[model samples]
Target: MKQIRNFCVIAHIDHGKSTLSDRLLEYTKTIADREMQDQALDNMDLERERGITIKSHAIQMYYDRPSDGKQYTFNLIDTPGHVDFSYEVSRSIAACEGALLLVDASQGIQAQTISNLYLAIDHDLEIIPILNKVDMESAMIDEVSDQIIDLIGCEKEDIVLASGKTGLGVPDIMEAIVERIPAPEGDPGAPLQALIFDSVFNAYRGVIAYFRILNGTMRKGDLVRFVNTGKEYEADEIGVLKMTQHPKDKLEAGNVGYIITGIKESKEIKVGDTITTVERPCEKAIQGFEDVKPMVFAGIFPLDNDDFEDLRDSLEKLQLNDASLVFEPETSAALGFGFRCGFLGMLHLEIVQERLYREFDMDVITTVPNVSYNLMDKSGEEYTVRTPSELPEQHTIEMVEEPYITAQIITKPEFIGTIMTLCMEKRGTLTKQHYLTPERVELSFDLPLAEIVFDFYDRLKSVSRGYASFDYQPIEYRETDLVKLDIRLNGEPVDALSALVHRSKAEAFGRQICKKLKELLPRQQFVIAIQAAVGAKVIARETISALRKDVTAKCYGGDITRKRKLLEKQKAGKRRMRQFGKVEVPQKAFLDVLKL
Candidate 1:
């Protein structure tokens, strides 16, 4: 067990963590030369196309230490760099003993880098700082090195300078992993207590759970049970993770591996649940990382309503792979059967939407994302509101509270004014401002989660010229003047278009949605009254004029009385049509309003 090293790579997005991981695999000869590829660990097609790691990947490698001339087992988990996938990172961290804190030499320290570093620290994991991309022309090695030193308070000589592209300084990193990072500690003779860090569904083989044995040992054909689910199954297969599964008869304490029990149901296996032998069960299930809290909520419905069950099955399988994704069955008046999915952020939501389409071959419609709100009704009862339609009627509400987040932004000093203005516009309160260096500044603000769910990140990047790195966590909910804005077409409400917005911006937001609907809604025979209303009062309105036939054009030689009579008849027809004519809202309009 002392000869084993379990560690993971952590970094900000695009900081070369995956690339460095590839080089590590090569240096360790885990993958043959021909099999080597960019972001090799990122196996998902969506991940490769987007040039990001959406999931954490684990693989085992054998490294021969030259100093001791001994073979060492290395369990390497490559984690995602984005904030939305931080839950994956945390799970990975819990299963490992150390982390490689990779920093982009050219970009220096970033918001996610700092955020991930704190997670590592909280886990009591050993941190090995690696300054990557040092070979690039824009690499600011000295500056970034100093920043890392100031942040972690490590010595200058301890920082490893490497380039993931050219495979430079990789040998030193491998040596550091063996020398600096501690090996896992557990009792092989004790009752089996394995922590199920992650799992994935397989069409042919059933469910494969990847776990790290904290105590005792697990062997092939052993009868095991999930502590949380209380379901028992024989271990059909047990293996260590490689480029492919390498079947093994037994996995000892301090080792990371996979177990297949032929459990076909996705819900039967839960990530973070403890797995132990039915014969010698552990005393208790391993308490894994904290529960994932979703920051954004949206409704997902199938384009073809008949695919609802398929969508549900797909989500269950997907959730097995991504434990952070949470969803519950919901219905909308306009969209019919769907689910209210809770996502970590917009990118997470988009990735899930894309994955459903690509992996499951299911067409889906995602409603505009919103943050959940808390409310107290006239009866003094508290309720959680996920959708605008869920908000109690205006007269029945006593208080509305929205989730606020403490956002940490790191950027150049010149954009400070614009960033402050942007946060203020979002009804944010500035909390702290500190200079990491003369050129770089870190600003902290408390902003509503709803405000940043839309386009706050994009705008922050644009205003900061892509120099700002943003990270946020939900804080306490506070009372606010929030209104449920409804979009009514011809006196009928479209529930999907309704949103809960801050009272101050309600009118302006309503006006914006009304204008957008006017532009996107197709013209009908009757004039469509696109009205944005609050309660019984209409705050904004736009009219889509009816398509008129040349009824007056045919009466060019008629008297003025005849023309008037024809116009009045046509108007009466339009009024009657308005009562029964249903407006066919284009799918594009529902998606486009999100941009507003």
Candidate 2:
């Protein structure tokens, strides 16, 4: 049997994990000359466009060395670097026995890098430190090495300095993996125990589950059963993928590959599930596998009710591949039927929306993201509501509770005062503060997660001139007096654009929504009334003046097509507006109101 080494690449955002993955693929000769692309492991267009690893991708590679006269198979898993999907990262780590911790040479170790490194340590994985971006002009190898040693508690000599973009030291890194990481140690004679790392859907082959062989050989036509779900199926065919380029044949014990069962749906397979033989099943599956809970949520409604089923199917397909995302049917009396989709964070929400447009080819109206709130009624019954419309009536609500987060802000010392003042203004309580470097400080605060879920990071970056880095984890829920503000245009309510805010900021929130609506929505031929009110009290009001001349005075039969096109454009523009019965609201009315 061939020896196998499994490892994952972990890093901070934009720290070259994907680029290093490409170099490793090149080193293993998995990709041909013509197939080379920058960060090939980031196969999704959305991931590449956003410059973040959204999904954890896996590949199998073969390495042969004449010096040692040995052939080895390496299973390389590239994990997402964002804090939002850290659960996915942890699962990726669980499927491997070692990790290549990539630290940017110029930027040193950031917050996410430290967080993922801790996860690796917690998993008991042997960490191979690699200093990436060494080809950069501002590369600081010594300082970064010192930081890695101090932060990760590793020796300086253990750090491998390399440039992934230039393919420098990649071969040596591969050799290090083959030499250092222990081969799969489970007994072939024991019951089959394969950890399903990931799975994908194929039209011809069905659900291809990628798993790491831990105990026994997984071959073609084996009767396998999922230990966690107690579902049994025959492994119809077994194959491995060269994720860098093409496909390969049957994979053996100790190698990472895919098994195509007759199971047609990808939902049948999940990450962290263990597959074993039915005759002699393993005692227990892997532990510590928890469902990924979404930290941010929003209402997603189709412009037309006919698109509801399409939207549901889109969300289902997306969830099949992405086990971390969650969604369900939600209905509002004013907005009709829609979905309340949960996301890892703001960036995750944006990526999902972008995918809906680009991949699913569906146009949707999304409400401002909100955190789920725990509402306590006068009878002491507790319930969770993701949208403001789902919340109980103000009179029925005895108390309002919302989630809090412990946020860490890394910024230049010059902006410490400004950041502190801003946090305080947002009702954040200072927890702790420490100097990270001579001119950098790490400030910790206990703030409402809802407050920071919006444009708080953007505002921080803007105020700090883009030199600030922030990280937050949900802390706990605290009671607060919060109210939902309903926005109206021309006397009708815009359900999709409703917002929840503290009673103190109700007027400001109303004014801000009206202002954004004016910018996003074009002026109409008739006067448009914009009004923001809480219950019966009008807090803000603005009017979009009607067009003086909406039609051409002079026209001919030949100009019919042009006139029809103009009217169509105008009608399309009106359709884009958030309409509440007789009222026509502009698109901007629903966007970035949280910025207020």
- Candidate 1 global Cα RMSD: 1.5
How does residue 234 of candidate 1 score in lDDT?
97
Cα lDDT of model 1 by residue, 126-154, tens digit: 99999999999999999999999999999
List the RMSD of every prediction in angstroms.
1.5, 6.5
Summed backbone clashes in each candidate are: 0, 1
lDDT: which candidate is best? 1
For residues 1-596, what per-residue lDDT tens digits would candidate 2 score against the true structure? 44788899999888899888888888778888698888788888888777888889988788887679888878888999887778778888888889999999988777778778888898888889999999899998888888788777877877888998898988779777877787767777777888887776655776677788777777677788988777899877777767532444444557777777777655567777999888888887867467777888988877678899989877777766677788889886555688989998887887788888888887777777888888889999988877877776788989999899898887778999889988987889999988766756788999988888877877887888876777777878999888888887777787777888878878887898888776666676566877888778889988987665545445456757887787777766655552522544443444455434
| Top TM-score model | 1
TM-scores of the models, in the order given: 0.97, 0.89
